[model samples]
Target: MTQTHTHTHTHESHPAIIKRLRRAGGHLNSTIDMVVQGRNCLDIAQQLQAVEKAIQQAKKALIQEHLDHCLEDLVGPLGAGQRKAMDEFREITRYL
Candidate 1:
């Protein structure tokens, strides 16, 4: 007897996303440096907040791009399947 399996995957990758993530990484490294240098708590908190927001924005952009490029393309016209997939995506977004 023989068995076969298949897997399909698409990566959500964009240059802008990469740039934003790199910026966030740099900000995080700076935040660590600030901690080492004993910066003010408020200053550290503000930098951390900025880093968090940058990461959040990057995530938002990546998801939106996936929806636009992959999901929207896959679902195409306004049909039952399309509507169901869109609804499922909307429900999933509640976590964000």
Candidate 2:
């Protein structure tokens, strides 16, 4: 069996993160309304794209804050496993 490691951090940007998610939720609702109203295809696509970007931005902000503040709590230099995890996180975030 493989052991799982967990790290905990006090999220200082929690409120800001919630605000961003709420904004994205609002954007999603607007997009839904546009679809229901039979809006133009181009307009609907643009709104969807906007919502996607907003969500990506929020994810980026949250990840950055985690790295900047939360990760700092680790004592001394990062070990191999930690470094690998960080690398994997960076790679996954490239889609944003």
Question: Which one wins on TM-score?
Answer: 1
Give the RMSD in angstroms, all C-alphas superposed, for model 2: 5.5
| Predictions in order: lDDT | 0.83, 0.80
Supply candidate 2's per-residue lDDT for 63: 83
Predicted structure 2: clash tally: 0
List model 2 lDDT by residue over 1-96, tens digit each. Answer: 998669554577877778888888988999999999999989989988888877887788888776755665555567899878877887677666
Which candidate number maximizes lDDT?
Answer: 1
Candidate 1: residue 86 Cα off by (Å): 3.8
lDDT of 1 by residue, 1-96 (tens): 898548655555677888899999999999999999999999999999989988997898778777767776675666897778877886686468
Off by over 4 Å in 2: 1-10, 75-96
What lDDT score goes with residue 1 in model 2? 100
C-alpha lDDT of candidate 2 relative to the true structure: 0.80
TM-score of 2: 0.65
